[model samples]
Target chain A: MSITEQRPVISKLEQQELRRLLAENKRIDGRNPLQYRNISVQLGYVEKAEGSALVELGNTKVLAAVKVGIAVPFADTPNEGILIVNAELVPLASPVFEPGPPSEESISLSRYVDRSIRESKSIDLSSLCIVPGRSVYSLYVDLYILDYDGNLIDASVIASVNALGITKMPKYVVEGQAIKKTDEYFKLDLKDHPVSLTYAFLDDKYVVDPCLSEEYASDFTVSMTVKADDRFCAIQKNGGGMISPRRVIELLERSLELGKELRTVAYRQLAGGNG
Target chain B: MLRSNEQQQRQRPIVVPGEYVGDSKFHIPGLNVYRLSDRMLATTVGLVRIDGKRVDVVALKSFYQPKVGDLVVGIVKEPGTAGWTVDINSPFLAFLPLSEYPEKRIRLSRDSIGRILEAGTVLVGLIKDASIFSSPVITLKGKGLGVVSNGFLLSITASKVPRLIGKKGSMLSTIEKGANVKLTVGQNGRLIVHSEDLNVVMKVKEVIGMIEKESHVYGLTERVEALLAGRRP
Candidate 1:
């Protein structure tokens, strides 16, 4: 599947025309801008993967998998187990993507997901290092962009984090230098959980969760990572037009307010409840 | 866009980069400028820059960047006469030349690259170039990035490979200590364990399978090792 094929091309002129409709409180989908497209999450889809999930926001779809293994430590930090994340915008997900390594866009999206979990202090990484300076368990989170509509980053992050949240680690022992596995297992200790929210500036207004067309014509985009305590762990912005100081303040307040609801939805899904 | 004096004053505290502001939970200190479409926003956390006017955004996790010289694992797909195409978990399929393996080199009048490297063959390779057109490119020119022989393949989470390796090979040593196995890990989520003892291979496979399912927990290594100890044959 080509990544480009998953997306519907809308030129700038076409976007402007759509925006005109949006300005009148009319969207192509005939809904308010703040209203999200349909959102759904499914877990345990990839039978081969230890843990897998699929998240769809409207037409965009992302598949996340969690793989486990033993690995040597990085040079800088030998004692701690590490977590790595990689994302692919498969040509099947959209036509713009070519079959190769990850694009910068895919990399950034994975990093964004990684940062929220890291900075929120969700999982204690230090505990994952089996033998400090000698051994550790490496967890790999691979995300495949199966389809592209809009709001992929948000969908990807939610699916990945929730998948990790629901994962269970096996019980093991290390006698001297030897490590062995047991039948027992336990779930991860997720403290002070975090989630990310995406906001788009459209028609000179900030909207939550823009679909493909609104995303196309939006003035700027902001992604905010909020921890359980509602602290901001990370934030990023993109656009040619600079946001005014007032707009920035307004956006932050709005994000903070919306994040609580998003977090609730994520937790319910992570807890195996439907969203 | 217009801002009142009070709004500008409130913004003054947010202009600095990496300065903690807002409430304890919402604070990121200073803000950095990032782009979306053609619009730019001074933000504190969870945003990204993209080409064109439309930008994508997400929360920031760790700051690990993709680089050359990294060891990766990929799957062989789309085969051609010149080379067999391998999907390295990136956006592109890495090419493995038949010339690289002088021992297994077979010549035929017909285009038969797929015969040598059929689809689903797991391989280990080095990231010779990560910024190839539309995706990263890998090469099998080195010692380890070639056909993995005499091993049972296991799939795990891709992110856990680094942690399993541990700082400077410590974690690998722990897993290999008693198992007596030659294990090869690929970044794209393929693991090959070679051992004469099927029991030991099965043990390692169980550990990896557990890790794949539970690597997101706080203490993954201990959990994996504990599981191994209980099931030792």
Candidate 2:
């Protein structure tokens, strides 16, 4: 068994070569730095999921599914219901992802999206609990990284937001100890919407939603989650290199710009779904 | 007096947060706001609140969250010294310890915990508890909860689970009868079917696959049965 695998170290000479490519505003794959890979979002793709969506960004593909179940609240937080988010970077999705417990990267990926939804108050968590201290409904959002090209965080976030938008919870009526469910359903209450935008700093110039090739050449990655109200909900800085404060500002502005477009695309695709 | 009060209450609508009181539930799919009292305007997200006169609703959003006591299907990933970790598709990776395993027939060996639970093992477990510290912990000692091995992992839309299960296990019974495959369904879309005949298993898996895909259509059970019957003998 191998002791922990180390990420590839970029030599000084290689860094110079990548920087030179970026200075020219040209990607090794012939894409302009700001250009995103081709993206496609399919809604209601998983028939088993209450609300499901598949998002393909370049070669990277992710599927998100939403399910609801009855549950008891935590002892401390009995009044509030629960929302569970699970992210799986399947070994099939990428070779680097081992078939074991969720890596820190995958956990962080789930958290970034989870925080955005929670802070945005996308769903009324309190309403989910049926009996304050006793039982309640819990919403589970699971994201499967089926194919990994690069920028899974962004793809997963997009798929989840759209899937949640398309989600509908079964209606329940509580009579004494028995809980009765009706044939009715309701959508989530996403007060302030959140969408994630990722940028890979290839060479030195930043590229919007990098593909696998660009990710290979890039040294730093940034994921920015923006709310519908134009507020920054979450920001994750990845990659091995250090990001200068000036570069952070630049990426933030670019993320906002790109986030608006991504949100519109997600809404349109989800709205057009036959739910 | 009681009859007048009942009539008045009927005239007023039932209100909830995030729901909009419109002419009907189909008016808006998301949250809707209605005036309850002069100072109390509640919000609703699902269904409309209308009796006959006043209506109260907020918005209607899909309700799919996780809570305690849910029978979840999860993937086994990290095997640690303390326990084997499972990803129940939650914000946190649910952990299952070897100690929780029931005392059974397998010979005892003081080996590594990770060795006993290699990665990729699907587990049907109960949520024992969750901690805000790091991740959620799960238990496998309960009835109908154990290690899932040697089966094809199938997924369906989370919303379709109720439909697949039907009211009081009706839907699953029909699928089992038609496909002749023993299946264990997890609420999180992870399903496993076991059968001795490889061909029959494959056929049954396909039928389940179709059911999962076409569940939104009316008469899904009939369609699944027809597909199963049409398979080669």
Candidate 3:
């Protein structure tokens, strides 16, 4: 129970209602067992940020903003650009979340989202390298959770990728070793589109895209990130529950299928229906 | 009728923030429209309603700003000595004082206060006092008010509450008759649909969603009826 505080206690009556609905293949909001909620992505809401997207998945809302700046790269990855993902679980989003430094849940969320984007090669980091050993462009993807209705990982992943898609880095005039900043900006080239799929472990069943109520009622959840080209990037099993080897395999196959369909939704929204 | 009406009104195109509408000298800037230098610009995204010489920007999404005498649906979060903290879907939680309670208040008694309004208890009441400097005050003193224990709550955009209720309760009557449920609508984008059958409550929720989506368009009542009757429009 790493979630010591800020976790809403699930009442017995509410759990019974949700469990009964799930057993009957009926969700609280009338969605199918495998069906995800109504997801819509609004791009470029924050003007000050280089890129921004407000993603609405049913009632769960997440805002992703990217800030581009010049900074020194890490020692080991000096030649490549940097990708930093920070998540804020603001108390205003849900009564359960607290207002302070990032909690354990938020830190884990940011790391998982970061691994999916970095390992999948979503952004071409090498191209962001203005200087091999010195200064490089650092992109910060900050996720602000505006609403908490469960399955936050999937929503945050999509919002971050969409924000990265719309990010524009400032251009610099390079002369020998000196670089001067210019008013012009160039869109960062996004290589791959990765989407995440989350499934909650209920009693002897796996429910995909669990709502807030269903999430609290469930025992554990598994989140899988897959690329558009059918490549799996990262997998995380949250909560203290054991899963059979057969169930793990079964989950991976189902997640891949859903990932493909969701990738198109995210890609199309980023391209304004052109994709 | 809709086509002629739209033409006669000279419909203003939908404008977003930073979009130029007209000159400030000729048209007075309304809500969400700010004057920059000599030009008028929109500060929010919504449909533009140009009335004579005044231009008003009506945002599609409405945030509830509290005012006195408005009926609202609130949920009790914490019980205090004199009043209970009720979340009225606003930036601030309202106070349901002991005077507004249906039961009489016992002087300096905490046990009696819990009996009146406890945590998780839903109430349908009216705002008795609202001050910018203080938390708004609510009262359970109106008809069809007090603890809402049997019904389900559904919310839509505050701007569409008028459309869902229709002009003079005509649209509301259509929904109630079509779904066979007693509906109470709040101006702050909350509603209570009471029906014995769970399906009727669900049907009313879908109808309200249709009203919100098509509120900007004309002839919404017929489409809403078609949705409730399970027919294709």
Candidate 4:
């Protein structure tokens, strides 16, 4: 019932050691500044969900499930389907998380995923229209944090993208004024793959995919979602900190390279079923 | 006193809650076991341990239940008017009253108390009082108990604390000697590793990680010894 977000108490000794390691372009986990932890993707993890995926970014685990339902289209975009993203930081995921209303951290995490998918045109929303302005398929992406080690943004993004990619919906035909369900089913047409990369700034240096302890010791984190074509679709910054214009440019360049690598890894796992 | 059955002790099997463990007439309920009529059932998911006539379930994972006289490492939380709230990695937050502090003739103001132990400060203390009615109280009046100025904190499952310490502190001594570092272990499953060398600290962390993962398996001590000797197990 505790809604307050409890930040772990980090000791001065840890902070100093982390900073000292960062000064030498090293991390406590022995990774380089730009190196990400091991990533594993499991598609269709939930049998009941229309589409589901569980992604593990190091120790951080996020499960994304897609549920399709019929709803009236929005007035502004009648021809497009609705994509609703909701993220829940389950209490069992970490000691800090509690059972209550969704925290701001969770709300913002969902919004970041929503923006990345919407802006990147990952799903062909227009194809989901049964009757313009009357009825359309609404895809709901629900993210559950199973384990929280750190860098949840990246893990959630990967899970969402993979879940949406495998989503399948029943076919519907226009019958005069009403929409009728057909026996045939069709898979969602995925247009692009978007992957997010998060970096935590420690002192003057930054480390990609910071672990839980590093996150507590860090100043802030910047997350960027890049499309398959090397174009940025979404950018978000969390925590209280400042970043220089030059450093922003450097992060963007790194995002472009790492984004492709991540997409490949995600897709290869899904296709090979090696996860 | 009842004697231990070596054959039964060697075949310790995992059991779920409500599963029948043994007959009540022959076995006594202990730890996470309950006597349901004439049968003994497990009250939690854990490995069964039969010591003499006592049938106890060693839970694989559980929250730390604070007990009196337990040494604990806690982090300073909010500073209240009467005392400071401390998080001891348990379900309940412990209280550290100003009176319990070793210092005497101290100012009673909140500002003065905050100066002594600010939020986020890590300290080692002993649980002086614990009950279901109120939060546990920890006192820093004992020897080797006070503010910890240096050391890296690492947390593991509280249930695995015994495995990490091993028999008669044998595993702990082995780790300290192998890694060349000092460790302050808390009953609440928090550890403070003190070493100037970063590599030594990392080595200790790796050993702890190994213990946490392989605690349920047999031959853990030998594997830990192999790891400490810088050989792959």
Candidate 5:
């Protein structure tokens, strides 16, 4: 998540040009109005972290680092493990981001990313449990925003899922009262890949993956995370404008369609070792 | 680009740390590769490049490593009594002492230093002194190397920078001629394209993306020229 300025961040002339381009079905970068920018995922970026991925979607960039720790399981979900998502918008990314605590935008970003993975049941949380209620593996997903152009949520979610997918847990053998870590490591059980789609509603038209300049041209932004099965796992609408029921449903349909296209590329790249 | 005989002898395989490259007897361990008894192991993810007895791994991803004789754009982050702590987009912030300002010999006082460069000032300078133990140093004691008046600043992946600046700067000239923009590319990944027209800036961005996406393919220079000429559909 990035700071959403109170006033218009883009120049009026730039905003006018963006709208004019969209009206003519021409994107500033020559992509179709319904197209998303090219996304490339680089895994194992932060070798120190348990698992990490650097996700680049056009000019926007985000890095997700996963750190696994052993902790007590929650009382209610004693059988399941915990996954905490934290996002930080680095000041080096843009001028608007200040050097300080996490912004409200970043907080929303972490929650949305957490919900997408959680609601989609992408990881087998139960498998992360070591001892029913006594001990469980805690996966901490720290998202560091390297650069913010636009559509941070979509990029963040993709990085988080792929980072978790490539994660491997060291073998743990529990004694009478002590848990010991072994030299062996087992790959994580990644079940599904979920992708998020951001559509900017501007003048009754919804454009996919709005760039930073184009972001300021829209009033309402609808973002939805779709699972591999074409199910909506997470959906959000940033404060701006409203959409009718028909429009929301139509956006959902489009999200599912784009979700398949993005998933194929995302997973294929995930399996590719170069990342 | 033609490869040296030794470069051809050394296989440029993408290797991760701890992966064995070759037998040390056949190939000597070079930069980013360590010797372990009889085998040479890679220490990073990069293409292994060898020139004669010297074998080195060229990493695709690059971090700003300040070295002597490199031209860099420095942003003034701190203007203190000692000197200015400039953000060179590196692991360590570089220091620009007041003495290295120019031959005119500005006063050593803080006020005099402020006159040269204040916080938020961006200057193009050279890495005069660089030591891993100490903060790297920069100097603005050369021509065309001083505070930038105004220009468009942008960055692409540092690894992809080589593609933008082609072999022997062939690609850089291609972009400058095709887009009609004077651009100075910093090895650290940031670039300054001097153009007031937004359309020109936008075109440069397209040119960069095209090169980055198709850098591996052959005959990229002509494709970029044709794209600039509006011959591409």
Candidate 6:
């Protein structure tokens, strides 16, 4: 038997109520329009992985694990280490997720995270290089959606960033064409932190960190990633609805502010020791 | 071993899947508890309940299992020539046949069925038949069973339905009277809340959320009553 994603049916009355609540700047969960749900970050959750983190945003839970290995660099970027991001919407996480190959949604999530991390230059890729072109460290960030209550992109980003921040790789020595491993290990050098903020636009009104029901009711969503230095690293708009340029700018400013707050929380957890 | 009456008075211990609940010799394995040789192990995350000689695990979170005569709030998924496919927040989609509808003899056409109950139309119904081999059949002929036109729907963990209803529907009545709203609770954890004031609806939603989260805790009813009276508990 084949398993398929089942979308929760939203009654017309609920939809109407959701719109009315948005007009009044009130949410069903009693949060303000620009406020995010409670965020909790746990580092080093997966002991076997080089680094791992579990982040819970409200009811949504995402786990990220980083596995580092030595591999030859790509032809175009021989000196820079490679970072591969993969996301899986685990079937057990939600009724809508099915066990199969990565869907378009998961692919888009991975790509969005990849752009945010790579474009922001969070990790010093040059430092991971064992040799100029022969061998370098390759980091694979695998994100598993443990619970999908919506705002998955932001939750995944938080987990990935914290996982990467605590990542430790075994030291390697260059001996001519080959690289030799050493007993010593060093933490991955992270230069910057990037946080993503997503907003679900319910008609003209928008809410930050929308829950599952809100996400389903929303017309479209815009996700903006900001670097620690207040730079816009990546921006993505999903769904069929369109947004005016003015709203986009407004969202960007909000993202910048929210991004700093998110970074503080992530860093505080990272510094407070493993959970 | 069975606990003494003094120990039984204490709160039930929460258990995770595969945890050793008790020995099968002293207590018979019940719901969500599997017998591994002579030992009973919990098969799901839940609270352990030992009643007489039976040990059962009441799951904290689970899908609703349909049973005959149980009231449910269902959303119409698709219309067929004979009936409509309805989602009842269960693993199996329940079926609502045209014959089961309260209406008199009507032509068997997809358009006719669609016009009667289109996709996403929320309604309350009774499970007429439930079996493992096929989808459960629901009937709308019963009183207070029909299309839910105005009220919005809210859902909590299906396992906590009993807690939300409370002893002899005491908790439900308290919330209804306190917030001035009527709730049509489904056995499947869905609730259709009827109220004229949006503020009352919000209060009901908040109270339900609190109950769902703290259903396992002791003295929850008293705290719920305190919260309803506009006092923080």
Per-residue error for A164 in candidate 2, Å, reads 0.5
Candidate 1, A166: how far from true, in Å? Answer: 1.3
- The better-scoring model by lDDT among 1 and 4 is 4
| Predicted model with the maximum lDDT | 6
Give the top-scoring candidate (TM-score).
Answer: 4
Candidate 1 lDDT over residue span A61-159, tens digit each = 999888766677787888777888888888887656778766667777888888877777777888788777777878788899899877777888777
Q: What's the residue-level lDDT of A119 in candidate 1?
A: 79
Steric clashes per prediction:
114, 60, 0, 0, 0, 0
Can you write out model 2's per-residue Cα lDDT over A1-275, one digit (the tens) per residue? 33444442222223344455567775544567776777788988999888999999877999999998778898888978788889998987764678887777788889988987887677778867788888888889999999998888888878888888888888888899888889998876655557888888764577777776456557778888888777788888876888889988887788778777777766666554321
Give the i-RMS of model 1 in Å: 21.0
lDDT of 5 by residue, A1-275 (tens): 56555532233334545666677787666789898898898988999888899999998999999998889999999988899999998989976777778788788999999999999898889989999999999999999999988899999998998898888777788999999888888877878889999998778777999988677668878899998888899999986677899999999999888888888876665663221
lDDT for position B137 in model 3: 93
* lDDT of every model, 2 decimals: 0.65, 0.69, 0.83, 0.87, 0.80, 0.88
Candidate 6 lDDT tens digits, B1-233: 35457645665789999999999889999999999899999999999988899998989888999999999999998898789999999999999998899988676643477888888899999999999998999999989999988877889889888889888999899898888788999999999889646778778888998988777666678778888899987
Q: Is candidate 2 or candidate 3 better by TM-score?
A: 3
Better of 3 and 4 by TM-score: 4
Model 2, C-alpha of B136: deviation from truth (Å) = 45
- Please list the residue runs of candidate 6 whose C-alpha ends up more than 4 Å from where it truly belongs after superposition: A1-6, A268-275, B1-9, B13-45, B48-56, B103-112, B196-202, B213-218
lDDT of 6 by residue, A1-275 (tens): 44333457767667777788889888877789988899898889999999999999999999999999999999998898989999999998988887888887898999999999999998888877878788899999999999999999999998999999899998998777667889999988777778899999888899999999899888888999988789999999988789999999999888888877777876676653321
* lDDT score, candidate 2, position B191: 68
- Lowest summed lDDT over 10 consecutive residues: which window, candidate 2 chain B? B56-65
Model 1: what is its DockQ? Answer: 0.01
Worst 10 residues of 5 chain A by lDDT: A7-16
TM-score pick, better of 1 and 4 = 4
If scored against the real structure, what TM-score would every candidate get? 0.51, 0.51, 0.64, 0.92, 0.58, 0.87
Winner on lDDT between 1 and 2 is 2
